[model samples]
Target: MKQVEIISGGPELLDIVEPLWAKLNEYHKKRSTHFSHKFEQLTFEKRKQNLLKEACDVTINLIVDQTNNAYVGYCICTVNKEKQGEIDSLFIENEYRKYGLGAELINRSITWLENYQAQTIVIGVSEGNEHALDFYQKFGFYKRRYILERE
Candidate 1:
């Protein structure tokens, strides 16, 4: 086990995010939990680039494993100036799952939101992602509303 460090997103960090995005997307697909899997058009690069750009105003935290210089996971949060904050996305590399990385990322996101004076945090997970739902709920997150979708 290596010392894990939490840091803000930076240019040098895209390398980590790009691979993590691919791994996470693959994980979701293999589990048949990717909401857009049917479309088969969600480009990982586009999403990674968008998230990197979005980091300018939003809070994105990465957990890096010092021993191997690998990005174990990341948590993204967006703060509304006057409303609750949003946990945009969170994913831990499958191999790194059980080492408290996900929780640490969530903790950092909450800290960032609190700094912005947000009292509550909101997160939306697709219905098919049972692991995510369970993870968030384990941290005391309750389902606030059902997001309905129509094909």
Candidate 2:
């Protein structure tokens, strides 16, 4: 068995997560036709800046393989002044999917938000991703809104 560590940090951690982040963007693009944002348009420096801005209001957690010092998953969550919490992103490497790491990431994010007194928590699932929807549903999340869009 391997030991997994969860570390919390701000955008400065992006340097360690960049490769996995790129893979995450690609994964999203491949999963949805509407996910047409040209991630390539942003240079890494700009992306890091954007992440820094986002981190100002959110908590970012990274799951690492302690032995090899590699990041294998991440979760980002934010709690608003209204006491509402939003899970901005969560992803785990494909090879790591079956080991419950994603669930652990989510559990930690939820606990962090609850500690801040969040009254409600929400997670957005891409329209066509049933697996993600089901995953969140398992945690007692239910549909609250429909964001229909046309290209």
Candidate 3:
């Protein structure tokens, strides 16, 4: 974890973040008690397209480990036409998890969203990853609502 740096950019960073995003998708798949199949169908390109929708503003921040010149984590932030903000996706490499990278990622991203005047910011945590609830709580994100789908 030596020589760590955080870089920020727009949609062009999407391709750069794909591998890390894939790992995050797998994590969600394993932890999702009911939506594993939903994740199975989610590909990087598909997800990118979702983010590219015309109505929202997108920004990404990546944590790079200069020691090996590798990207260890990334956070994606978005704000829609309605000024609704979202910390849409966040992940830190398993090797990088215990070192506070995730917290830094969310903090910087949320600050960016706030600077953009985000009216409301939210993060959608998949079910079964409830272990992260406490982490999100530290950033002042609490469970205000949960939507269940009939399967």
Candidate 4:
């Protein structure tokens, strides 16, 4: 059995998540029915830049396998000055997904966001990724509305 730990930080740690983020992008690409092209275009650098530009406060929680010295999962939470919170991203390595890593990451992020006095919190799951709806609902994230985008 491997020991696990969670590390916390801000934008300074963004580089560490690139590989994990890329794996997430590939996951979406495979599951997507209509937006694989969008995922294909979403490079980690571009996504990182967007996060840097938009988020006023950021919390990145990384789940590490201490013995293996590996980052098995991560979640990014952001809060703006207006107290709007977002679970910007989350991913766990395929093998690690069965270990409840995703739920742990979300719980940590939600607690952090609440600590910041966030009035409204949100999460955006890609169109073809509705399979995660049940998982997210466990965290009190129910769909309020949907914004359909055109091709």
lDDT minimum window of 10 residues, candidate 3: 49-58
Candidate 1 yields a Cα-based lDDT of 0.71
Q: Pick out the ten consecutive residues of candidate 2 with the lowest summed lDDT.
A: 35-44
- In order, the Cα lDDT scores of the candidates are 0.71, 0.75, 0.90, 0.90
What candidate 4 gets wrong by more than 4 Å, as runs, is none
- Residues 75-126 of candidate 4: C-alpha lDDT, one tens digit per residue: 9999987889999999987777887788989999999999999999999999
Q: Write the per-residue lDDT of candidate 1 for residues 67-91, one digit (tens) a residue.
A: 8887778876776545568887788
Supply the global lDDT for candidate 2.
0.75
Model 3, 54: alpha-carbon shift in Å? 5.5
Determine the backbone clash count of candidate 3: 0
Error in Å for residue 113 of model 2: 0.7
Q: Give the TM-score comparing model 4 with the true structure, all chains together.
A: 0.96
Give TM-scores for every candidate, taking all chains together and pairing residue i with residue i. Answer: 0.78, 0.82, 0.96, 0.96
Check candidate 3 and list the clashing pairs.
none
lDDT of 2 at 45: 65
Itemize residue pairs with steric clashes in candidate 1. none
* RMSD (CA, Å), each prediction: 3.0, 2.5, 1.1, 1.1
